[model samples]
Target: MTYAFGDTDLAARRLALLAETFAPSSRTFMVEAAHTGLRLAADLGCGPGYSTHLLAGALEPAHTVGLDNSESFLDLARATASDKVSFCCHDITTGPFPSGPYDLLFSRFELTHLQHPEAVIELWGRQLAVGGRLLMEEVEYIGTTHPVFTSYLEIQQAMLTEQGNSLYIGPVLDAVPDPAALKRRSSNVQTAPIPAERAAAMFRMNLGVWRHNDFVRRTLDPSDLDDLESALAAIESGRSAVSSVEWGLRRVVMDRVDP
Candidate 1:
């Protein structure tokens, strides 16, 4: 499945915010569930290594492998690598998982892009060592009291739905076998308090990524895209008011229990 947001500089910046907003709590939950000691870990769809870096720092694993299909993303990820942190370029869906029997396998916002997420989970289950953990996070829904951001999300969800991905992949976690557990959490990523200039700048950069997406171009109206651009510009210029945008998230932490 194609990523709705291609690997680009703008996409990388957005992902940094996305990870920063959600990954801390995810790490906390994983630590609690896995009981604090991780020897080896794999970060699936590591996406510019934000989450991978987090895992490396928090767990201080003997080895941390960050995997992604995007060469561009991997290139950036590699720049940040240390002796303990390494990056590999490979498709998470079709390629073999990076050499493992890993203590922890983590993915964020990636299941939604996969056609066979359950199969992937099963693969992870097999690769995880006994007492290992599989941690995942995905967008449950995007919400806002603001009208313009709401419209933006509606359009975003429409494109995702058309591509056969769900904005909310939380329910899919239930279908994974026993030993896996799930929880819902608020990302606490607020939109309103953002300065008009910064919000506009961020959304404008986001729009650039959206405009380049093949699925979005094929699915979203050209005029609607133009209108979004104008609206964001207006909000940036203080000509419009929009408030309180946030994304709800679901966190799933599955422990591998050997039968």
Candidate 2:
């Protein structure tokens, strides 16, 4: 699948290919304790309706809003929006987030995609009601310490800096726990490796990012586009020694501490 923008949903689909995808230490991370009692809930950037389905299932007793910027994605959500759930196509970066004193708000592997993740987090925080919970699970690529992945990451870092951009994922993960410049919000941040199976799947799903990151396309292999695709595939293989070492994945759970 192409990761350009609608990649989150594509990645989510690839993750649930197996039955155990969301089984705790599995390919997906979702709360199963039942959210039916929540007065309101939302899964912002609920691409492809994967998480939308999960949220709707859990919040069956309440109205759940699925907000996203892609109409193609919202269409997928509406197909499953029976009665307690509905999809809203919107560019949350601007305009209003649907009305919510929502008791719970979440996004899986979602926040890091924004150029202004901090600002976006602040916005979501604003929509949260008293005693509400805002949780975001993101890729917190802590280190390039893996023996093989370090090279690719180093190259990525330099390439992004040259393009006047940062690597964007891990750094933001580190910042979520600190709400210093954000709107009045108290939060907690935690990180852990997603299951190897799921991690590899998500990375593999976005196999095209190497070409989209500008740094990889313009600097890493500017003269060898074909070689770049080959490398991306290799790194996503999970089993290939070189790929396993080069592509690593993890998730962060950021929660807006309930008052």
Candidate 3:
């Protein structure tokens, strides 16, 4: 399945900003969930290697691999590779993963873009060593009173829904029964409040990437999109004193159980 956001340079830039904005929350999650002396770790859908680097830094795994399907993104990721960190161009959802029996598996904001996330989680769990952990952070809710933010979110959600994916997939994942090999250890929501300008910046960059999609073109008025873009630009420029958007991220931790 194609990512709704293109893997162009602009998209990479957006992801960089996204990584910067969300790193604190993600780092905290890793520190809280990780065990000492992990042998191997994988960061799923590790676009541009930001989250991969974060994983390595936070957990200090003996070896860490970042996986993504985009060669363009992998190229950027490879530039920053080290003895402990590496990049692989692979689709995360379908995997006999490059490395087996990982001690830790991490994915952030990736499931919302994929179909059958529960199955994906199960697949990831199978690649973990016994008692290894799989950690996922996905959107539960996005709270904002800004009309532009609301409008953009609605359109994005509709487009994802049309694609048979969900924008806020936390609840869906929460309801998934634990697979035999992966027992749920913890599930909870963590709030990350993003500054209005920063939120608009990310949203604007995302809109630019997916605004030309067939679903978007067929369903939305071009003029409205243009106006929406203008409104987002205003917010991104700090001209609008909009309320900060609060992201309620669902964090789930599962342990690979012995078969």
Residue 17 deviation, candidate 2, in Å? 5.9
Q: Give the TM-score of candidate 1.
A: 0.83
> How displaced is residue 242 in candidate 2, in Å?
7.6
Error of 2 at 256 (Å): 7.3
Candidate 3 structure quality by residue, lDDT tens digits, 1-259: 9999989999999999999999999999999988869999999999999999999999899999999999999999999999999999888888689977799999999999999877888899999999899999999999997888999999999999999999999998788889889999999999999999999999999999999899999999999999999999999998867889999999999999986
Model 2 worst lDDT window (10 residues): 242-251
> Which candidate wins on TM-score?
3
TM-score of 2: 0.66
As for TM-score, the candidate ahead, 1 or 3, is 3
Q: Ranking by TM-score, best first?
A: 3, 1, 2
Per-residue lDDT over 94-208 for candidate 2, one digit per residue giving the tens place of the 0 to 100 score: 5457776567776765554465667776677667675566655553454435433444456655654554445546546555544432232322334444443344444445444
Clashing pairs in 3: none
Over the full model, what C-alpha lDDT does candidate 2 score relative to the true structure? 0.54
Q: Judged by lDDT, which candidate is best?
A: 3
Would you list the C-alpha lDDT of every candidate in the order shown? 0.73, 0.54, 0.93
RMSD of 3: 0.8
lDDT of 3 at 5: 90
**For residue 147, what is the lDDT in candidate 2?**
36
